[model samples]
Target chain A: MTARPFHRSQAEMLPERAAPVTTAGVVGWLRANLFSSWANTAFTLIALYLLWLIVPAIADWAYFNADTAGDDRFACKSSGACWAWVDQRIGQFLYGFYAPDQTWRVDLAVVLLIPALAPLLFEGVPFARQLRWFSLAYPVVATFLLVGGIGLEGIPTDKFGGFMLNLTVGLAGIVLSLPIGILLALGRRSRLPIIRILCVGFIEIVRGVPLITLLFVSNIILPIFLPPDVTVDSLIRVIVMVTAFASAYMAEVIRGGLQAIPRGQYEAAQALGLRYWQSMVLIILPQALKISIPGIVNTFIGLFKDTTLVIIIGLFDILGIGNAMVSNPDWLGLATEAYVFIAFFFFIACFSMSRYSIHLEKRLDTERRD
Target chain B: MARNASARRPGSPGWQRLWSDERTRGLIYQLLVILGVALFVAFIVSNTIANLQRAGLASGFGFLFDQAFFDINQRLIDYTSTSTFGRALVVGLLNTVLVSAMGIVAATAIGFVAGVLRLSPNFLLSRLVGAYVEITRNVPVLLQIIFWWVVLSGLPKVRDSLALGDAVFLNNRGVRLPAPLFESGFEWVLAAALAGVVATVFVARWSRRRQNESGERFPVFWSGLALIVGLPALVYWIAGSPVAWDIPKPTRFNFRGGFNVTPELVALWIALSTYTGAFISEIVRAGILSVSKGQTEAAGALGLRPGQTMWLVVIPQAMRVIIPPLTSQYLNLTKNSSLAIAIGYQDLVSIGGTILNQSGQALEVVGIWMVVYLSLSLLTSMFMNWYNRRIALVER
Candidate 1:
């Protein structure tokens, strides 16, 4: 029976059938995606030539001719980037003039943060439920470690100057803005007209102006509104303004999440005899916030990048510190080098946040589909 | 509004809701919020006045009339150190608008082209576009501004400027280019061009109506373009070519007679366009992708050529998804133009910062900033919304 069947179709039993010239393997893929037409071929060639020109120059600058481990700019003067400058002042770039001995405090804060944040960020991590308490306590503990108050030797606001300061602003803004943003989102959706109007006004006004102007309010104008007995320092005021700015953005993001929820869910919660707060806390917010994770992270990234604006008001974030370093007589013309180093710092932070957000999006997407 | 079935009429005792009622609680909460807000604002205001008094700084717009001793490097209008502070601000505002408006046009052009390329059926080219987007978006734009500033400023000195033919020169100082000096009677050509544009719109409308009524497709695009270009040229010839070129000539240290654009402006423009273009490209890619493959298949089934399908079937649908985000990008570009201050470009924020520091009228300066920015935002959003409605989906 097998012999009869094999003989029935000679073509099937013969050697493997050949795919068409234009539809088989890598060559076919190249023809289909890159060189199917004259326009596409020309584009491919042009892009290849461009890469040829740029890649070599960048590689030569960043690697081939790049100097490392030396502190002297005079010793490393090439047509390429002066990476040696970056190596010499890495500490200043990271800590921004925080007393050298106090660098450990900054390290401690970061060390504590990893475990606290990991559970929340990764679903597969162990003891995520119990770790929620760690997440809640992290901000206070980190802040105390950073600024040094109550028990530790206090690092004055002025001494807080570098990339460490950027972290401070970003973390404070992220943590503070989350709750304020949720409240604002709920307020905007409130049945009460006044509350809705107030929320809308705050969101619009804050959103309308640029963040630099808001920082100006914190730097130059906030003290004018404070009582004589109350002394609010620059860092605290800037944090407050940063938090406000972040909340406006986060509010809009959460509002989008709230809007995506079907009307049936709200009705179902009401039918269950849940009060407004109860319905929101127990039902609406959880689902809405779950969907909003990507958006919230996106806002956080924006807030982190925006810490650079603090430099406009003369605060020394990482970039500000880099700028200050370049102004040194020792590194006279190394602005390009210093700025490149600073850019790498930002690129890593932003890239990872964006990647994590995308990962969460994909993970959540499958769960939703199921 | 109808009363709930379980509730009594307003006149009855049961009609009066309990304190536990949600509506009553909501009202009470709103009342408390309003009161708290009012009290907070009053407190801030009182403290501000007390502080202002202690500082002995007069709060007024009259400072705007005072002579601005500060010299503006780049001025579109006639101004000097003696110009009023208000005038300097006007110049600064004009500078800001000029950059943002021109930056918007350039960014949109670059973004659209890059976006189209990002979706090209080419692998390497698409990857190149992807790399561009990732690199631009990942690094802080401020760093880009600084990098570009250094690059432009590192150009040769004025005496050793890079000459591109005779009309343009690039140097550390600026790029000088030949400016068009419109002679007398040039306005007629401009008028003709405007008339041609108006006529083209009418013809397009007429063609569309005819196609709708009789299924007769007119050759509108080509003929309209010819009319617009040819009509203006014909008028220019009739008017004896009334325009002159003010070519810059090389002097000992610099070029003379032509216009100069500063390195600051160039750096800011390039950085802003490149940065904003990255985001715009993503929007464009998403817009194009949102049009499902079935759309193109359906177009093919209906006997539309590839190009026609692109124009008629694909682009129209894609634009619906594109424009709202595009409006926000425009708003963002305008706001981010505030970064122009970092590079010493005299934008509104920069000018305001100057006035604030010089006059120390923090309250008034901040107020002006709020008002101008808020108004600009409102007007832009309103215009975008109106445009959206005009082109929104209309069901049959």
Candidate 2:
């Protein structure tokens, strides 16, 4: 009422203005991410061009022009991939020569792995203590289910082949290698010169040679080293060799973890009058193992991929089975399809395992920060 | 108290002292370990002797001198089917060296490019590079080797080769590239190139000193490149260009005249390099990232351009983090080259495997494999250590 409402004492809020289209929408995101500069725009164009060159061709070959619904090679007529070979041999690829009736046992063993791994891998599983007991007994149960003993009809070792063989060897190696690796790592770090030297020697020798040579040793030389009266199964021999190889690598990884722990932790344990094993078990190992989880997982992935090397020693793993399939007259030219199928299997297995490791690492990082 | 003290002395009950005294306990444990190892060795030795005798296999290096009748498709040296097993092994060793060296070169080039591209500011390029790394690394290398072999062998027949001009040809048999035929005067060109390199090194040192004193920059890199290339060209001109190309000529069933790179070599080379390159790219990315952002900012504050900052501030620091793992990657490539056996690439292990089967000398053959590989590993690490020391940071 004085001069005007313009000079009013009460303030009114103004409406929020919209961000400019150039900086705050889909177009803005494209500009920021792909066309931030002249060089970046050019790169984006080139990348798109390259992807255009590769992606559609692969899709056409793998899907559009591909023939997957076939019982034999002759049923495939596409200029692209012939996946009929993969289709017909899928069972053999998975179970090898495992009896068709006993295939359920292999499937059960594989399914049991999830529950066995759950308590060890995750923090909030129900009845985790009881699950830990199952985790401890998983190897025995898996062995009985797959290999058979104690009321189960036994499957001969030769029947174990294909991807089942890979999973069995890899899982067994991963399970057995950890405790041995821990012992070796401790030995390498031991105050006693003899123990340290022996551990160091074992690790260096194993790591220095190729796994192929070790497999050769297992195939031809291991039997020579053993007593003649005690004939170990070839599968068992391979598992033993693979475990030794992985454990040597695992020892070095664990040693890195052991070294990373602050010296004060050990001193503190000693101050509490804890003996060597007690300090290691109660105070040291948990922290070291947590730090080394990524490395442990990496070693497991490597060992799993390396199970393919058993094919070199003439064991019929998945790759071996794939090779055998491709050589058949019905699938003579289907090597590409066979190899791609096998590669896809490995990629899925390894990629998921690596992702899990990264997840665990992030969790550990958050816990440490807290 | 006196009895307790006396019990702790040297005259105590042996078993009690062994169990109670820490020093004695450690000594006993070590002795036990040694004895156990000795017993294990004795058992293995006794068993091996019996087994070898039963199998009627000769043991020792004696078999190495015997004739290796098997033919190796890819041999680096002059070895026929008539060659001794040792010569065949030497040929295999050379082949291994050839592939490893070539694979190392290609892997380094691919790794550096992929690693830098993975961190590109352009989002799409980075994602593409990331995809390449993930897909290549996760797949089994043996499968990759076999896959590549299949791909290579699936190429068109020699009669239908995909020719690049008259100088290069590609087919199922492999690549046929024009080989340079050096005449008498070519040595002078090589000498000139060597001289240019030596001169360039001196000039670089001189230019660096001049920069320190006068703050005037010399274009050392451009000048060095010009010298290396220009001097060689000049010499070649003066020597009448004593080089000729041996381009491939298509024959009835194959190509001749050019250098024939076998399909097995191509497959092994591509697979090993690509596989190891993925690992190396990851190493390189980690190395580069370990160089902090503050470094670039600090360099910028000091008025260095972005390229200069990368060259002078980032890369030098990053290299220290890179070299150790790079050495390991190199060793891995060398070791993985032994996977040549899977695809019949005629590497040391493949030849050795053949020899092992022929001679039935598993012990000796395995021993040779271990010794040679161990030595190779040791030699590589030693060289890498030297290089690392030369580039190491100097601290007061």
Candidate 3:
């Protein structure tokens, strides 16, 4: 038996296996995910064909045939899209009745927002370390850009009704509602019966209603409850309604995050001799917030999309501007093109947010998995 | 000495002492919040009063009973311009309910089919469904509605309307189809139909019980269908066929006297269903994907056919994941139906907006909107919660 074992060789003893190139490369992926069977092969071909049909058509309509810049409809005749409709009314779409020459103020505000928002969204940015100052300065800077004080030409709020208005409403709603939502979530989970009941009641009642109804209340019924001297701007009314609506939803999301935190974390915080607020702020909130980033971003996307509804109230958001484009005598027949343009704008914003959410979800999942 | 030392150790309050303490800090915080809200409310109330006074207008809900001079183009109930504002509002509400109910049913059907198709073993079908979802969901529903309206309106005018033989007509006015008109004994036929429904339910239950006891499958689908549909028709025929068909004919200016859906309603319905179906499809795809491959393989190993495996094993579990998000899509559709206002569909919001402008009673009108919508949202949530509980996993 010992003499027979001496004839063993590496090639003969080991079973033959496919090479790495054959087993794990591009061809393998195609075989596994695409052409796994005859049916799959057919499906892949059909999918490719459909893509070929749609992708090129979309490209042709959006870029190849689209009119990029013009003041009137004649320039866009026979072209796929009259983007000139957007360009001609661009100032009106951006600032509504805001004094045309003073548009720079709004432009400046938009520029400032990038820096303020970048620190908050991107974790690796060093600017985030100065978030306290950034947050404090944001409101003042935004006010200067929008309302025009401190030597800038004053663009009144009534004139501020368009895409910029929609963004402002949505952004303000998110910023104001988030802190309120967090507090409401905390209170709802609190041990104190009174606080818990109050928070729960407010959240439930607000959540029960639609934002339009809330806007109606703010626009109509609210004035009845107020004093004669107090005149609220229409924009402010919308903001208030949006904030209330968003806060209810945000509270629910935050509550879910809070509930997901382990009891051990709470116990650890307590053992460290931290008070309730201190423990929550220091230990619990950061983790809960990270976990809920996807939900928060989703809410932002929803709110942003909903801002288009302002057109119903007679404010000129992007949708309103698009609608207005169709009624122009010269562009009467180009309603399709105008709507397509508006849809593309909305789709870009929403798709980006959704994609970022997926990316964040992956990153967070990896961290947790580790 | 030992007891005194233990009780009075430094400034640490004993549990008993803490329990006896007044909750001043908590009370103050709560009071502050309440005061802030109250002041804000008061400010709004006062401003409204002053503005109404300044405009030389009065504020009250009594205006709801005043004559509404505007006539609605399409109404669910009988309404005239002579009708009171309150009655007109009711008509608008009914129309809203009708459109939303129809939209929900259509959206669910399309969404479910598209969603399941997105997970198809066939790559083409899945990608097609995926593209449909991505394109539709990314665009604003408002834009979609407007686009549909424009497309519908762009169809040839009534003179050159597209005709389906002589029975159906399509034009800017709307699509017209033959409507059924009951002649005689329609009530008896309706009663028979109701009876058929009851019979079908009982038969279904009995068949299930029998199948469980005897390990034999019954032809429940065919039997149920025969009872529910065939039986009713049979009863109607025996009652001397008490229904006549009214086919729409193209007249000089427009098609006359059939079941015509207005272009506005068509556009709204199409937009709502297509837009919402996209989201629903995504939820459906995610739900199917969430199910582990092991389950499918095990079912296969047990010799279950693909259809049976999907229906009996995969779908029931998948529904637990699908139904919750599906509920949100339904809510979204309902809310988005308000976009009909943009096209003058006279939905609840549109009517409410008109009333607000007319009476200068902004506060009252807004309150009504809030109350109505809030109830709607609550009702939706309640239904969804019941559904969720029914399909929810039962764990010990």
Candidate 4:
């Protein structure tokens, strides 16, 4: 067969021209996105009206007319928000009935967390490989920092309340649950009948009941169960309950990740003559855990939010403190301001964690990325 | 070289071979685990017995039959302060079920609307829905409930109560809606409604078969709707309309005549629905996204309408992803009903807490809570599992 002639390439190109006003500019964007059709135009108007109605009022209430200088109950008498009340009582809500002297311990606990956790979370951080070990010691250090025993004066668990207690329980729960979750996940997958059943039973039962019921059990029934001589701190008991609950959810998530791993990866470990634990630690867990990081963080978000449920158990978590602040004799009828502040606090925590988790998920997307 | 086939093996294997043999190792590990767990359990049991003995607290569920001696403000069942603890618990459980069931319906409706809007072709609608979801999702649900409570309580007094055509009344006390008071022939009307539902199913099946075999179109949805509505109304008319309206009236102190729904229930219901809806929208969005774009294109190429493409192709695949997580959301809503305790809503846990304090049967009360909650969880999951199986893909 005869060959076809080759096409020649142009050395240069004509200057680029702007697109027509109907299709390329701001007007075009509005046309294409907001007012493309009758339905779209109607929707745009409805959305705009809703925004117009709500946005200014909320902004006005939150900032402009908000009373920021006074501390009296009627600071909000003019129908605006009472930021003044929040300003006066911020410390009380943040720390609850915590000892004023030992408040620095709470600050130190928070400050120490960022540095201890940074290396493990981000790339190119100093001592990244070695910092994971610090997570183990961080909780111990924090416990002493809050309760104050070994080298410092005792503050007691009763003093641990508000956002301080929430952080303590939330952080400790996440850290403690991870390793326990891994073992339970493995046990559920094991061929051994008893271990599998035990792991399954624990996960199912823990997940079935609400955390409030568990908190009640921990606050009341746990003491009845334990020996009279051994006295566990209330905060410690709450932490254990919270940790056990989180571990069940974590196990389910990690199991999903494990199920996603290829059979060949496991069989290869078996081929290499590695023991079950060694193979899981080296081959299976590393892969499984990497995939599960996002899910684990999601569980952390839920767990942290659920910590506010401790309010029902009479623990002054952030929600509890907020509730307490509103009902204060001095700041009565400031439920709006109190709730708004606590809502923002929780929102910031949950939103940031979720965003970071999404970012990490994108970065760790080895298999899915094209 | 290996152990002789004819030789009898030792009953108890040594540690050296236990490592070499997988089955032996598994068995040994399981045995050790059982022993450890048993010993720890025994220790806890002994400790609990000793502690209970010293504390003078007996741990048995015998108090269930004893009088509750507590009045629940909002109850479905006939419960008095002198009612049995079991009856009080039943009232609590009934309240839990009512709220959770209603919340599920409301949340699902809100969720589906938001989910659909989130993927709207109109950018403004999508963005608005997205913002709504993000704001609702980020904040703690408890705070939302509290906020709603504050807002609802801020409503005007009973004399100045908001009225909707004199059929409903809203005030600080609660919302009062006109309730249907049925007379004698209501049972016949109900029977007619049941027949309508049965006939609609048969009609749907017949329409599907007719369309498949003869390529003829049928107004199945319209007919089904008409039948369901018309049949009950027809029967009611024939029986001289055996239902009377008990309209809510704004009395001096409170609304009277119609059923009153407490503000706590309203606040809890709205908050839970909105909060869970945000989550459900995300789940639905993900489910829809999981079905590839190629699916729609293929359906379009087959000459199916967009609606048909959705119902026949995309939704079927999306449902596989949606159902499992939807079940979890349902379970979450059910569990969250316990949050009613915060606002002094008489849920099981709250009532149980009262029983525990009054009777000093903390252990037994806690056990009751566990059993009831666990049973609920099992039932919900079992039902979901069955439904999931029914709708699951048949690869073969």
Candidate 5:
């Protein structure tokens, strides 16, 4: 036999002895992750110290010592937090000044939103193609339910407030801005120079300025520009301005998607004797929109958050309702509680949307890879 | 004969040919758009004129020169209620610039630290940082501003100020800090600092050249730090340390005379920094992740330390990914500063609102706001683009 250059473990495989304590299991993980070096040890200790300092205090204030129920400040005897104010005004926070009896309409509309969004946000749902028709008509039905149309009792726009108003403005803007945004995106890339310039100019100007300024324009300047006898509803005006602002941003996002389409794809469509719009609708836009779903969702989240800006112009969204509640004599000095409550609502809405977008991105990425 | 009849001829009628022609269709479409736009503009102009006349509101910008009767709580420049509306607006703009600049600096610092720490080997630290990013980002910034405002305003009363080592004070009113009273010869110390910066730059260049030539590595960081600190110190000592402290002292009701940071500024500054910092941190994390793991392994194989690998191999590549989004975040922070109005921080939009109400020149005031913001956005984007181009990778 040839002499072995290296020794080999040939004694019954050494009975498969376990790894040493220092290099195995929990101790090994700790050594590798948290105390691999002096700096890492220090970082871990500092993090622990910081958590020790902050977490308990926050937990105590927000939960352990907190007053969770009551009607007013007197009910909150604890020094931690006065959540009683939030508890008392939860209705106003949810439905604003809407008549309590009519809140069922708002509730129904909100419930319908799930089905309306399901077909768009997910794949493989039952009868998704048929459900899209409901999605298309859902916006109108929801509006009618909330606003009181042909068959329902009349509810003026002024009466709209609270979280309901936020959903209204955000959903309406999302639905309305898309078509306009698509057109603007096409316009910006059109063969006609004037259309491109006009589209570019509108987008830049709107994006450069804050939403507050546009709201101000709608509040004060829009009236001056309209005909003397033609008075538009304030909520409608807000919706119009919001749509304009959102469409500008949306157009940019869609344009990014449009630009990403390979020249070969356009050529392929053209070679098949398709008209411009037909090619866009049948081939390009479907792929482009799928690619831009994450961006569109992000824009929607931004628009949803921006609905709070209407408070600055004197319309009471959820934040406005919270602010107004805080200023009430019975709830004075409860701004923290009010803001926290409103922030929690917004956080839930925005965070879930972001999470969904990330999930969709991953799914789309896998699909593309496949 | 049928095919010939169906086929378009060169002698076809002009109207029919023009109708069918793509180029002519485009031209006609553009002309219609122009005409429609002109008519719309004319209608708006006519209605606006009629409305202005009807309301008896003057439309000129002359109101800018009129006295602003309202008191601005946080003016960076010299201003009183008697100051012109223009001066008040200038004060507002300066305040906005101050908050935005400070917020940007603080946000960047926090963002970089949190981002790196979040990717640390220590699981607790990373999770903590992740939580911070998610919670802060998901919350609306307006609510944060108001929350901070309320928290700051709910601090101990002026009489029971929270003192910090006898130099800083905090109360419901705001933070009070000792102001530096600069005397003569401080300019010499400033000059020394400037000279030290120049010298450090030169030394860095020299060291780089030396390294390239002879494979020598200089202690550039320590030497640069020494130069910057030592020169300033020497000058300060020679100039007799011409700076005195003006520490705030508690009086009957409020702190007496040092420097006062109003609650509005404090609240707005803190909220903007924290909120924007969360976003910036995510951008930084993404950028760092975009730099492949192969880079770190390669640096290790080349015998570079972990720190050196991060600084030299990873960060340079990461910066390219970080910068563009970072620029947008900066812009977002600047624009979000307009929300300062919500908490009475008296930024440009707030001041403009007051001016609009007082002067009734809504159009001009809004016009000024649009122009100013547009220019600010343009200038920031231009500067950031230049910086981005300078650091971009040179492809082979």
Candidate 6:
């Protein structure tokens, strides 16, 4: 037998076998995900067909034949989207009634925000320790840029009413409401009878009513409760109402996160001799906040969308601007294009935030698993 | 020795110390918060009064009794330009309720069908449903409403309106369908029809209990349907079929005599239902998916058919998950019904807006809106909570 093996035939000298592709590999993935069954195959085909129909039409209307370079409606007659309306009103849409020359200030404010926001969003980045101070500084810087105080000609709040105004309302509400919301959440869970009841009542009442009603009340009823000599700007009233509405929702979301945390964690903090506030700030909040990030982002998206209701109160957010455009004689019957454009703008922002929330959720899940 | 004495002083009463300790500072904090709230409220009231005085506007519900000279395009109750502002508001509220109710029914039906289709074993159907959901949901509802209004406006002129076999007419004005006119003794028939509903509910409960105890299935659905539909028809027949159908006829510029759903109402309804249905569909799909596959497998192993297993085991459980979200969506749809203003549907918000402009009683009008909407929301939530508890799992 050994002699026969030593006489080794070519048949015995085979090459090493290759590995088969996994279900997760490219070709196998396509088969599994897109064509695993007859039903899936049919679904893929139909989806492809529907997409083919829509993609070209959207492209043709939005880009290929769009009047991107036009100054006015007269320049856009290509049987496609007349984006000229957007181009012409872009400034007004951005800064509403803000003086034309003062748009640069708003732009500058946005530029300042990016650097401040970037480090805050990136976990474990340098200056993570400085984030609290940075948060405090942002409002001051943003206020100066927007309100034009201290030798700058003030742009009245009433004049701030468009896409930029929407952003301002949303961001202001988010920033202002968050700390209050956390406190409210804690208060609702507190042993203090009066505080818990008040917090619970506030949250329930606000959450039960629609935001539009709150805005309506702020614009209409809030003034009646004040003294006769005082005056509040419409923009300020809207901001306050939005902040209250958002805080209620945020409180509930944070409360959910708080409830989800293991009781042992709180016990451990108490065992370590941390005071209530200290334990919350150091031990509880970080984990609770991480858990509630998605909820907070969802609230922001809702706030952003709801800012459009300002139009009912006579403020010109993006939706209001679009509504304004439709009545122009030159843009008559062009409602479709204007609505489509605004809808796309809203969709892009909301979708991005939702996707980011999903990513955060996945990351949190991984961390929990580890 | 001094430290030991101080520590032992807690024996005097730890609870009393906790209650009285200045470090806790409960009274001061509570007083501060109350004071802040009161001060803020005082400021707001003063500002409002000043603004109202400056604007030469009076604040009250007095304007509600004033004659509303405006003519609403649609009204559930009889109203003309001579109606009081209060009456106009009532009409508007009814319209809002009407549209919202119709929208909820249509949306739930469409949502359930689409949601199940999205999970269909049939490939094309599922993809189509998925695409519908994604496209509809991703777009802002305001845009969809506007789009529908525009498209409806683009239809052929009223003179050359799109006619469905000379019976139904679609025009810029509205879609006209045949209206039923009740003749003499129709009230008795209506009473009998209502009686049928009461009977059906009783029978359904009894049959359900019977089935539960005996494990014998009853055709409760068909029986309920027959009682509701067939019994009503029988009553109508016994009352000499008192109702007559009035078909709409095209006039020079509009259709006449039949019930017409205005373009504004149609557009609002379609937009709201379709947009809301997309979200509801997702909720439904998620609810179904939440039911563990093991339950289905167990049912199958017990020799139950797929359909029977899904209905008997899965859906009852899935419904508990679905109803809560469904309630939220319903509330959302009701709130979004306010969007009717954008398209000129005379909903509560629109009418309130009109009242605001006409009377400059923005404060009062806004207050009424808050109360109405908040009450509506509270009522819905209470009802849903009760229903949820009734269906909730009773874990042993």
True contacts kept of each: 0.78, 0.88, 0.66, 0.82, 0.80, 0.49
Candidate numbers sorted by TM-score from highest down: 2, 1, 5, 4, 3, 6
* Overall lDDT per candidate, in order of appearance: 0.87, 0.90, 0.81, 0.86, 0.90, 0.83
- Residues A70-176 of candidate 1: C-alpha lDDT, one tens digit per residue: 66777786677777776668888888889998899999998888889999889878888878898988988887888898878888888887788888888899889
Q: What is the TM-score of each candidate against the true structure?
A: 0.95, 0.96, 0.88, 0.94, 0.94, 0.86
Stronger candidate by DockQ (3 vs 4): 4
DockQ of each: 0.76, 0.81, 0.48, 0.72, 0.76, 0.37
Query: Any runs in candidate 4 off by more than 4 Å, and if so which?
Result: A1-15, A127-136, A366-370, B5-14, B55-58, B211-217
Please list the Cα RMSD from the true structure of every candidate, rounded to 1 decimal place: 3.2, 2.5, 4.1, 3.9, 3.1, 4.7
Off by over 4 Å in 3: A1-71, A74-79, A84-87, A95-97, A126-136, B1-28, B31-64, B185-189, B211-216, B233-242, B359-363
Model 1 segments beyond 4 Å from truth? A1-22, B1-17
lDDT of 4 by residue, B1-396 (tens): 365532336764556655777788778888999999999999889988998899887778788899888899899978898899989989989989888999999998898789978998878789999989988888877778889988888788778989888798888877988999999999999999999899999999998899899988788888888789998999999999899999987767776699988898999899999999998998888888999999999999989999999887987899899999898999999998898888877889888888888999887888888889899988988998998998899997
Stretches of candidate 5 above 4 Å error? A1-25, B1-16, B205-220
lDDT of the structure predicted as candidate 4: 0.86
Please list all clashing residue pairs in model 1, or write none if there are none: none
**Ignoring the other chain, what TM-score does chain B have in each prediction?**
0.94, 0.93, 0.91, 0.93, 0.94, 0.92
Clashing pairs in 5: none
What is residue B330's positional error in candidate 4, in angstroms? 0.3
Interface RMSD of each: 1.1, 1.0, 3.0, 1.2, 1.1, 3.6
In the range A1-370, model 3's lDDT, one tens digit per residue, is: 4575554555465778776764478877667777887978887888898889988888888788877776677777554666777657767767777888878878888888877877765668775768757866998889877898678777778787667887788788878888988999999998766789889988887776566666656665655666655678888888887887788788888998999999999999999989888999999998898888877877777777778877766778877876776888867777877777667767888888899888888887898889
Using lDDT as the measure, which candidate wins? 2
Docking class of 1: medium
Candidate 5 structure quality by residue, lDDT tens digits, A182-235: 999999999999999999999999989888889999998888899889988888
lDDT of 6 by residue, B122-229 (tens): 555577788788777766676788789887887787898888987788888778888999899899888877988999899988988998899888887888888888
RMSD of 3: 4.1
DockQ winner: 2
What ordering of candidates by DockQ runs from best to worst?
2, 1, 5, 4, 3, 6
Candidate 4 CAPRI category? medium
Lowest summed-lDDT stretch of 10 residues in model 4 chain A? A71-80
